[model samples]
Target: MRLRLRRFRPRTGPHEHRVVQPLHPLRHASLRDPDPIGHLLADHDGLNRLAGLFSFAAYSRHTVVHIPLRDGVPPDEGMGELVDLVLVHHSYGLRPSQWPGLRRRLTHGTPLTVRTDEARTARDAAAWQARAHRADRRDELRHTTHARTFFLFGSRDVFAEAADSFAYAAGNGPLHKRVQQGDLALVSAIPGLRQPPGGGHPFEVLICFKPYPPYAHFKRPGR
Candidate 1:
């Protein structure tokens, strides 16, 4: 995710509501793997090399690992081989309904990350549908308290840029103001750095980079 940081310039209407916070990854370049992951997934939250957070529910089977980018880089800072499994957060994997076609394209063993338990509940589904504007079943990935995402990247530049933009804008200052208020637009593949499309109308550009896992993501001590 690479975002060129810019303040959202209001282009229409009066009573412009400006968000005084750094909206992070919006309108940023994304680096999708450009391929689909078939059912080869074993661990739902497979680790990746970047830098971010991970959580264990204290008493649950699910653990969430966040691999956020700071800003867009030169386009090859974080490129990895296309893995057999994809950790789909927010539809990060091929859609289940569309999985058969995806299976045909890639190797078998891919699995989608249905991030939430509420994905099974109708009440949560309805509310999620009302609040989201994503692909058909993206909300299913928000099952846990953490709404992190995972996607195959095309280039490292996108990741590097996202990191740079977010780091510059997220601090408590002018940029953070608009960001916190939500009067800004974001559009980044990394989510934390997303700025809305054509968001120059009242929404400020609070560029921010989402975090990724450390370079030694799977370097759990001893192994």
Candidate 2:
């Protein structure tokens, strides 16, 4: 997977700045695939890539990645397409004021506990509701996590831009309901420099966002 670096800034409020730690795929040949368990293996008791400012994890059989930008990029035109999955750790992902709450949650829990797990549980519940609402559940995609990680599913044509609201629209009608349900967020599609092993099919982008109240204000386009 290819990686890009960026930063997050709160629109308003006090913030705790996180350090930027880079992920080197070359260090671990086994990282060819962005597997959640792979990330844990790489964690090495929180000393590995999983502990870095930017990292990836496996959630619900999908590769979930996290990234912490050093400077705010504001989701501009320069944003590229990501290959596999990306994890973003920043206060902007959630409401500006909720940062402290998130930090407290993380600190109060076990050292290894990730606050995002709370959202993931919420996401699973939402997905179950979605399934119940649908008449045909065979093809339904479950909302596995609520980390606000954007995914392109290897669709390089997907594009993203800075928006005044938390919502996004790519003109995919069938996805509208899912987007509205907070199952996913639209983000600028970025091209990662790394390709899959043996130059196989295109990789996708998955970004795990920081949990906070700021996240509740997301208003997608064409909602």
TM-score of predicted model 2? 0.21
Alpha-carbon runs more than 4 Å astray in model 2? 1-33, 36-177, 185-188, 207-223
Return the top candidate by lDDT.
2
Task: Give a tens-digit lDDT track for model 1, residues 1-223.
Answer: 1111212222122322111111233112223231221111101121111111111111111211222232333222333232211222331322334333332332222222222222222332244435456455332222111111233221122223322333223321222223223222232223222333575542121222222223333222233
Cα lDDT for residue 167, candidate 2:
17
Question: Each candidate's root-mean-square deviation in Å?
Answer: 20.8, 19.6
TM-score, per-candidate, Cα-based: 0.20, 0.21
Cα lDDT listed for each candidate: 0.24, 0.26
Off by over 4 Å in 1: 1-152, 172-223
